[model samples]
Target: MSDFASAAMLRVLVQGMRELGLDPGDAPPGDGEARVQLGLKQGLVQRAVLQGGLACLPLLGRGLRRLAHEPTHQALVAAHSASDLLARWQRLERYVHSRHRCVVEHCDDTQACVRHVTVTGQGAPTAAEDFVVAGVLAALLESIGLRRVSLSFGEQGLFPASDPQGLAQAAAAGASALWQFHWQGRPARGSAPVPGPAAWAQGADPAWAEPVRRAYLHLAADLARPWGLPVLAGAMGLSTRSLQRQLAAQGLSYSRLLAEARCRVAAWRLLYTGDPVAEVGFLSGFSDQPHFTRELQKRVGMPPAAYRQAFAARPVPGR
Candidate 1:
């Protein structure tokens, strides 16, 4: 699990390959739970299955053509806008406990800047894995009736990628395991409210290190529950000392994870709910508004209100 991907993701890559008459041999288990994770150490041999999945533009398209039929594909196609689609994507990551995660750092009418990353305190995902994920995402957009969707990976460039070839070229262009996913995906359909962070753990670390993952999930379950270390530990069926030791092994503190969970809840409300900022703070377990503002400011590099305004600036699909 720590080094592998979900069975669903691997199926896309493997099935996509088979669709193009390519053989993806012997995909490995992610965490002994039947996940076909790409690579933990990122060794070349470990990537054989992932690499053989798709090689070029035409092959990539033919390989991934089955994406539209998958159960996940059906759910993603229901997304009313690009933001809603990604919100759904983030939610799915939690359910599958994926090692890698994607986050939209910025967006507008014609472009969305995303960051491909691993969960906190985990090893980074390889570039090849990132490329395959990018290919799948592009195909997903196409399924949603979106056209002219192009993607480019870089730290600074916001240029267009006219075809899948450009995305493949940029995947091998850098050794950096983590890079920006600057893609063109305009939001579509009419607006609809996204589910809250309770159902969708957006902007929070969902995997890596079992204790931390569980702690974040518990915290996100109910931010305003007046939870403390003893309470959380008790709920997880561990003594306080034992729980503390587990968290220490991961270099995390209970309060820190709680704060992060709160931040995620606040972000979801800001984006999808028309709730007042004060109300958001209260529901996120902040007894004080100033502390909520300060904590969220540190994590997102902006105040809650402004961060909402900046990241939610996308246009309607057809207009």
Candidate 2:
């Protein structure tokens, strides 16, 4: 992904974290700024937040970079915790919106800028969250004084029944991009689409910062793989062993990431599709149905069949 796309992804991520109700702020020791600077220098930001949404920080950082110009990219990895990134995103979103008048202009068809996110992951299926996030971002753009916006998502994103209008409204207002879980080549959860620069860049946020955005795109595209540690490591230009060490510094591992991705994807699939329990398991990286059932129960508090029965019966937004 280009730096521009990375920055946009970051913006959406930070904005989403704020909506999740976490404290995303700078620390008193000037350490917060230092961390960000360091992350820039290192060209990466790696963190694992227990309950604070650190996973979304890189995206936030990418967004913030567009507003400022700095050279520290490699040294910046593993800087802020997820909480810090969220706080920064909230700050930036407010900063941008306060200065501009945002608008939403839907394209009769998807535009090139909008295609960046979708093209990053090979064979990845687009999700409703992409549309949800885009709408939320449009609202934010309008709030910031941008005059026009044009974006679109796949058919899955269009159905009123699948993506809720209320959630879309909240996301557009710089709130969390309400998400829904689903799978493509592998199990994945779709996040709200990041706002485009044309929509968010109103001369309020600084420019000239390129590295942060680069890192953001790297991270976002990196994470989309399904249990391919070697592949992800290669994409980031790190050796598998080195990658493990870096992730260790931030309290994460390939296995854990794989598990998290699988669980979220499985949860979404269970709730969204009519796929059989065994198929959901297989698609989610579970080799056996029993293991899939056990894991589903652990994460969702119900067996796959039961979870589907319950979710299928419930009313969904934009359904």
Candidate 3:
């Protein structure tokens, strides 16, 4: 069918499943000119922790990260400008020969939004599939060296990406999924450098953590304390200004790190521990129960209880 995904793309999902400690129960689709059906893709994603929650972004991002080495992504990375990148993307859609693909609704110097619909002007029936699409596009953007990039997915006034309260409301949207992409222009260098890996995906408990990650650990150690930049900077053996510059370079701030740490810790506890959701949120740097539910809901794409149940349904690894 025209609504099919590339085998290379599906393989990335397989890797994400493996990493999440989920069993690769069935053989994922394989690469070939013969198109693999979208049903295969839908079946694969249905097995994930949740359909569309905050966790979906990074999980899909993690899977699509493999695309950095694929041809479509490589071509996108090779694009010289933001508009140029869109042009190349249009060309890639043609090359795929899929009726269901992303089409640019508008473009400009600052921000642009792409609508993921079919030639019939319909969005993917599956929410998770659309998410996979957004993740790939986001990866391509990051490869272009736009360090501070975030995306809003919904129709106008449904939800702005910045409004924490409305994420899930927009997420529950039906067909006709839209993606509004925001990014900073490339650095003031000689020319647009070749697209490499998206720096944002360089997270998780890597062998060597980023400076911001070290800062995350420090802040995570005590989420209740109202620590400032100076104290954290000193703890990291960096001057206040130096720490600010470093965090800015990585598209991070101390508060952002603290929030992220809480999210990470909360997710971990929900999945592997029997702690009550309220208690888990409290220990993860959240002092207010309602605030904890809201933030984690924004991040993980659901309430704490729901998130725990989603992943908890998965077949644990090594069992």
lDDT, each prediction: 0.57, 0.36, 0.59
Tell me the spans in candidate 2 whose CA falls farther than 4 Å from its real position: 1-228, 313-319
Q: Write the per-residue lDDT of candidate 1 for residues 204-289, one digit (tens) a residue.
A: 56444777677787777655444689989987888999988887877777877777788887787677665455446655666545
* Best-matching candidate per lDDT: 3
All-Cα superposition RMSD per candidate: 17.5, 22.1, 19.4
lDDT of 2: 0.36
Winner on TM-score between 2 and 3 is 3
Q: Please, what are the lDDT tens digits per residue for candidate 3 over residues 1-319?
A: 3575555556667766666566546855454231356667667777663533434433554554554544333445655456656765554454344566777888776777888777755544455566666666665667677666667665422211233235345556563267777878772332333221122233344642377667776665444334579978987899999888877877777677767777876676567655445445544556445777899889878998788888863532320
Residues 76-100 of candidate 2: C-alpha lDDT, one tens digit per residue = 1111222222222233222222111
- TM-score, one value per model: 0.46, 0.29, 0.49
Ranked candidates (lDDT, high to low): 3, 1, 2
Q: How far in Å is the alpha carbon of 23 misplaced in model 1? A: 1.1
User: In candidate 3, how many Å is residue 145 off?
Assistant: 1.4
Which 10-residue span in candidate 2 carries the lowest summed lDDT? 70-79
Whichever of 1 and 2 has more TM-score, that candidate is 1
